[model samples]
Target: MARELMKGNEAVAEAAVRAGVAAYFGYPITPQTELLEYMSRRMPELGRAFVQAESELAAVNMVYGAACTGQRVMSSSSSPGVSLMMEGVSYIAGTELPMVLVDVMRGGPGLGNIAPAQGDYNQIVHGGGHGDYHSIVLAPANVQEAVDFMALAFDLAEKYRSVTVVLMDGMLGQMMEPCELPAMLPMKTEFPDWAVTGAKGRERRFLTSINLNPTQQEITNLRMLNRWAQVEANEIRYREYFMEDAKYAVVAYGSAGRISLSAVRTARAEGIKVGLLRPITLSPFPREAIYQASRKLDGMLVVEMSSGQMLDDVLAATRFTVPTEFCARIGGVVPYPDEVLDSIRNLVKGPLTTEGHPRDRWLKRMAERN
Candidate 1:
């Protein structure tokens, strides 16, 4: 297939279509509205289901309903909008339904802005909904990755019978890049045994998240926990650059990781032994890889578009044995490669220590700079 220049959001929509997504239900939200817009036109042309629901809540519930039928269903929303869908997300997870969700993160703890940010790391990666559930979260750093992960999201969701999220920032959502979308997949003719399809001549199947009995709920929770263990064992993914002989490294994900690559390259050019580690799966984070790298490195730098959210994970992964520094551009501000490069330079020059929290030190640095 020929690679064509495509906007990130539109490419993801087309990718999902090619992946045999049977239904799409979403509300218009910036940085991701193009995804819904594309689906609105394309889904109808392909005879698939598409609905621009009245709100995010309605949209997620529609996805939940479609997922119960064992169909490939999805919804896309930005930060504030996704927040509105939390209850439905929890419901879908508790019922052990498979569904895909794309979260094109924008600035926020609230309706902050339509600019790119990684503020939703904790929300999406840590299961924003109220429940003992886990979402298989994939963080893609570019348009190509965003497109590719759409199909993978569905596969993983079905494989684990759980929610899967394609987590990218607004930058990746709105940016354009050359990518080759996957070939169109034929929709499934056979439904899973657990599907809530009509009980025509067979046993009536029922699917619900509600478990009134405490013992039953505990069993369900244990089932989910065991499934999650399988995910952790089989699915941790990450990419490394210039790390074979490096003394220092930068750990990031999504857009921040993409930008950090440039810094890592520049640092190498200056004869500084620095590398990069970008996590592909944020939920089943590549803890072992980071821990292994920490054993050989003098220090690590974490870069993000949020206030040290992923940083917490990195610190725990390394057991705080190696000194770690942080650089962040929060509230819609995207940090430039030079900023990360500076952080790398500091990491090399530091009397690095693991005594205090990396965020606290980063906060002190931020105050000093301002």
Candidate 2:
């Protein structure tokens, strides 16, 4: 396929269409609105279903309804909009329905801004929706990655009968890059046996997130847990850069990962033996890989566009075996490559300790710098 210069959100939307997405339901929100706009035009042209719902709540529920029929379905929104859909997201998870969601994250604790940010790390990766269920989350660093993960998202969702989230910051959503999209896939013709399509020919089937009896609810929860175990074993994904011979490393994801990569390269040129670990899957979180990397490192630096959310996960994975430091630019501010390079320089300078919380230390450093 010939490569085309495309905006991240539109490219991902087209990727979903080519992946045979049968229906799309979403509301317009900045940084991610282009995705919905693309779907509105393309879905109808392909004779597929598309709905620009009144609100995120309505959109997610519409996705929920379509998913129950065993068709490929999805929804997209920015940070605050995603919050509105949390309840419906939980309902979908509890029912073990297969669906995909794209979260083009923006700055926020509440109505922050439309700028690119990784602040949704905790919300999306840690199951923002109320439930004991887990969603498979994919973080893409660039437009190419954002485009490619769209098909994989649907495949994984259906494979595990779970929700799959393509998590990206607003920068990735709005930036333009050259990428080759996948070939169009045929729409699914055979519905799953569990589908709630008309029951005229077969036995009437039912699916619900509600398990009234306590024992039944427990059983449902157990089933979801067991399935998640399979996901953890088989789905962990991450990318390593220049780690073949390194004494120190940087951990980051999504756009932050992309930025950190540049810093790592510059640091390498300056005789700093530092590499990058960019997580591709945030849920089945490359824990084992990080643990192994920690075993060989003197210290690690975590870079983020948020307030060190993923840093906590890295700390747990490494079990504090290696001294760790953190640097971040939260609330719509993106850290420059030079800033991360400076952090790398500091990481090599020593006095790094595994004592108190990395965030606490980072806060002190940030305060001093300001």
Candidate 3:
């Protein structure tokens, strides 16, 4: 209602209540513990339902059960726990259920430490579950955007009648920021008559992805692909800053995007022509925006917490008309301003720093502290 200090996970929880989420089912996991904590308190206040299922696996299935009734539901977890939920996500997507999931990512191919990381980018955006289904993935750069994006995720999920996700990291979830969310909008979405709720007078309806008939399965796959094409036509979203008169473009998302914004401004002030392109929607990613940037800039620099995830999309969008450079920080560290600015300077630069480079200097500082 009013502006207040909140963490990114807290904002997601608050936004869930405001988005008219009918049910929440989740199990505990770190980096996202606050999200569950917030829901534990607020879901009761709204007379809604909240259940901590036996495990992440069960929690996701519970969400599936609720969504089968055509109720809006959500669940949240970290990397390891989310891996367990993959089986259920596949089921939900195969049946084409409309539900939202929040993933506060941490490092790993396994049970990693409780720190921020973007290693899940491919898994979250590329459909981690088996099969050919993609979730509508939203990437938010700050606490405010995180709150705003989660609301958007709900709308898209129900609109496409598909699963959607808000992909964020530990920095956003654990840090504090100002937020003023609006009043909860009343949701009035309905299940199609084809949906199998109970089947009273007509023939019984079924919800299953299994089609033993090859021809029928082909028909279903093509239909889903067509829907994805329609979504791709309308779903790309992005934000740009100081790029109208830019010689170079920088592509980044989430907290890295925010850091890149400051670096672009800093580079400009130092007489180097640099600008930023930040993607808000990771799936059907902001391709058109990237193509527009490539038309004007010489080359674009792609930065991320993990190696080469977002860059792949940038290259696909631009198709190599412009050269690209990449810089990344793995294992949960934010990209330093100097490293980004140094990328600009390497090709074309202004005499601003006589002290080698900012990232090298910062890394040494980190080494000393450790």
Estimate the Cα RMSD of every predicted model relative to the unseen true structure: 0.7, 0.7, 4.5
Worst 10 residues of 1 by lDDT: 351-360
lDDT of 3 by residue, 1-370 (tens): 5799988898889888888898999998999989998898899888888998889999999998888887779999988888899999989988888889999998776786888888889988888899988889998899999888777888898888788989888988999999888688886467666566787888987788787898987888788888888889998888998888898888999988887888888889998778889998898788888997888887677878876777778877887667677666778676788877776666464332323433454356446747
Model 1 local distance difference test score? 0.95
- The list of candidate 1 runs beyond 4 A from truth reads none
Q: How much does candidate 2 score in TM-score?
A: 0.99
**lDDT of each candidate versus the true structure:** 0.95, 0.94, 0.83
Residue-level lDDT tens digits of model 1 in 196-227: 98998999999999999999999999999999
- Error in Å for residue 367 of model 2: 1.0
Q: For each candidate, what TM-score against the reference?
A: 0.99, 0.99, 0.91
lDDT preference between candidates 2 and 3, better one: 2
Query: What tens-digit string does per-residue lDDT give for candidate 2 at 169-208?
Result: 8999999999999999999998888999989878999988
- Better model by TM-score: candidate 1 vs candidate 3: 1
In model 2, where do residues sit more than 4 Å from their true spots?
none
What pairs collide in candidate 2? none
